[model samples]
Each structure stands twice: as C-alpha cells, then as structure tokens.
Target: MERKHFLKSLLVGAMSAPALLAACGKDDETVAPSTDSTSSGSCTVAPTETEGPFPTKVPASYVRSNIVDGKTGHPMTVKITIKNANNSCAVLSGALVDIWHCDAEGNYSEYGGTGMQATNYQSVHFLRGRQITDANGLVTFTSIFPGWYSGRATHIHVHIYSASGTSLKVTQIAFPEGTGSAVAAVNGYAKGMNGYTYNASDNVFSDGVTQELATVTGSTSAGFELAITLNVAV
Candidate 1:
C-alpha cells in the first residue's frame, strides 16, 4: 500500500493525522546493543512513544518469550534491558515488558478488517507477548523481523511497567541502516521495500532516534538478533 492510501484509510478509520503520527514507530537501523546505555553510559531516558491503536488488550495472558505464533519471516531475537535512570543506570529487575508489532506483511495481530488494516487477524494473536525482567533486568522475546507499513517505519512497540504493575514507560524500538536489505530478503509480503518508510521520514522517529535505536545483527537466511537497553526513571 502507498503512504497516501494508508493515511487516507487511517483518516477514514476515525484516526486523525496527529493521532496516527503519534501512534507510529521508527524505521530500520543497525548497531550493537550497549551494556550501560543506548550510547555510552549516558543513561538518558528513552523517549515516551504512543501505545495506541493496536496494543495487547490482555498482556498478562501472553507472558511468554516466544511471540512468533505461526508468523513467517526472518527469525528475530529481541533482547531488551531495563535500567533505572535514577540509580546510575542499574539493572531494574522484575519490571514488566510487553511488546507488539506487525508481521512480515505490515499487519498487526488482534487488529484487522478495519480501514487501517484490511487483513483479518482480529481473532488471532501472533506477534504479541509479555515478559518480566530477570535479575539482569533483561527480557528476551523470540519474534520475527517486523515489516514496514506505509505511514510508519519498521519498528516495535514496547510498554514497560513495574513489578507491581505500575506503568513505567511506553516506547518503540528503531532499526539501523541495514533494515532495508533485511526487509527485501523476507520471503512473504509483496511490498518488500517498495513503499517502506525510513526513520528520517517516519513521523515517530523524524526528530531523532538516539535512544530508541537498537543493535541489529545477523542475516536474512539465518535470521536476526536485536538488542536494546531502555533507561527509565524509577
């Protein structure tokens, strides 16, 4: 789908332009996950992004590491570390991290048959899961490399909460430079990189992606690994 058509569909779906922009994520990029921070040990708080339009309505029901429930694409291992910005970037154990994203065809599960997404995946949950941080403040999810949509870039939505269930931060992960190639290599999906939007033009990532950028490695044949550390003010 072209960008304009997607935007028109969103408008017809009762989502305004500003709301749609606020609800999108970023494009692809590559880097190595940092140990202490997004870059160096700066401990900058990851920016708060939107969680709307298509969030997991029942995250507690899907507390598993493998979220790829029958979806096809390059295998992706998503490793996210949560850090406490108030405590010198210490690993925040026991935080709740929930993530959801579109499948290889740029369509999200639990949401379809609408103007925003014509695919009917509303009855199934494919790429959505939740996990609690371990002692190392890390949560790993086995998923597929997400495809891009017309108005937004290739990205993932993340919602973090405390062990007690208090919402901490809501954000998205951005990919690096090699994402375009990865998308093109995927088997399913007719779009490929034709209408894919880059981070520079992505409404959710145009300003900057310093904190949201993730380190992506591996090949389309072997799959990919993504690692990102999110700093939250606790």
Candidate 2:
C-alpha cells in the first residue's frame, strides 16, 4: 500500500526534539468513547505507535497551549495525562508531551507538495506544539478537530520524553466512531466523508485500539473536548 510504503520511508527521519529549536509547530464527541483509558485512574500502558509522516522538527520552540496557528475548523481542546506504568500508575509530572496533527483539510503544516500530501504548507507551522506535564501530569492543547486522510483515521501523533529529554515513547491517539460526521461538518472540507478510513481499517489501529483510543465528548456545533490518559514505563 502507498501509505504503508510511505510510512516505512519516513520512519528514519521522524521528528525528534534535539534536531533544532527554530522549527514550527481535537475534537469532542458527537462520538462515543473508544476505551476506558480516558478515565483519570486508568493505568494501562498506552500502546506505542508511529509518529506518522509529519512531525514537528523543532518541538522545543513551540511550547504553547494553543497550537491552532490560525487554522480554522470546529474548535477542540485536547487534554492528555501522563502516568508511569512502572510506578503504580503515579502521575508522571515533568514529562515532555509533543503533539501534531493534520488540519481540518487533512493537510499538515511544515509539509506539503509531496507525493503523500500536496497542499504546500511548508512555510508555516500550525497545529503543532509541545508542553511539559504539570504537577497533575497533564498537558492541554487548544486546536481544531482533525480531518481524515486517505488511509488513516482521524488521529493525532504524540511523542513523549523524560524531563531531561530522554525519549520515552512515540504514540498516537485515535478518535472514536462518528468522526465522519464531525469531518463533514467542517466548513471548507470539500472531501466530506468520501475517502475517510476508519480505525478498523487503519494500519496503525487495525490490530486493536483499546489502549490508544481516546474519549471524546461534545458536538460539532459547540466544538469538542478530548481527554486521554497515557501510561508509559519510566
């Protein structure tokens, strides 16, 4: 498959924090919760997944809560909590959490004009940011509900690291069902629900989504909220 081939090719150069500091840098539900891991008390270790083709090369520079970067779509607020699987699920405060995703039109910033993505957003950075986990082991980002791509479901890529910059995990958050309708509701997304791939068919999610699935709440009209707990061995 083209998507699988592309993913394999990009694996070597996936984003990392030590590269540079000058690089750039969600939705609720009309949907059901995919798994129980969203609960604050769940300690199941989150499944590590690929960071995908696009990642923020210089994550350290974009350390803000709002990663919208002027992109327009239904509003979304993403909350992620980090927990240590090796320590009785204790909150892993001070971990670095970095996230990036496609915009409402399924195009990623800082990348485009390639065989996989052709939108040409290489000049600007939007929908990408990094935040350090707070005392509560949580990092929140203000963003827009992501749109679908040809072979992947609606999702977000996350990279976690220790406080001292040691790499911990590279994973992703999968959206719940009913995400198609939410994508259709986006104003300028002409693709609508035409070529969307659901979690069941997604290469990264097909095996299972029990640990990576997120709990989404809210609606297209009022925007949405996503909350997920990620447990990693520290």
Candidate whose lDDT is highest? 1
| lDDT string, candidate 1, 54-106, tens digits | 88989999999999998988899999999887777789999999999989888
lDDT of 2: 0.74
**Which segments of candidate 2 are over 4 A away from where they belong?**
1-42, 179-188
Pairs clashing within candidate 2: 28-224, 28-225, 29-217
Go through the candidates in order and give each one's C-alpha lDDT.
Answer: 0.78, 0.74
lDDT of 1: 0.78
Query: Where does candidate 1 have its weakest 10-residue lDDT segment?
Result: 1-10
Q: Candidate 1 versus the native: TM-score?
A: 0.83
Candidate 2 lDDT, tens digit per residue, 1-234? 001222444444653321211111111111122223435534556665656468787989899999999998889999999988767667889999999998878888988886667689998889999999999899999999997667777889899999999987777888877535443355236666765677777767777777788888777789989998887778
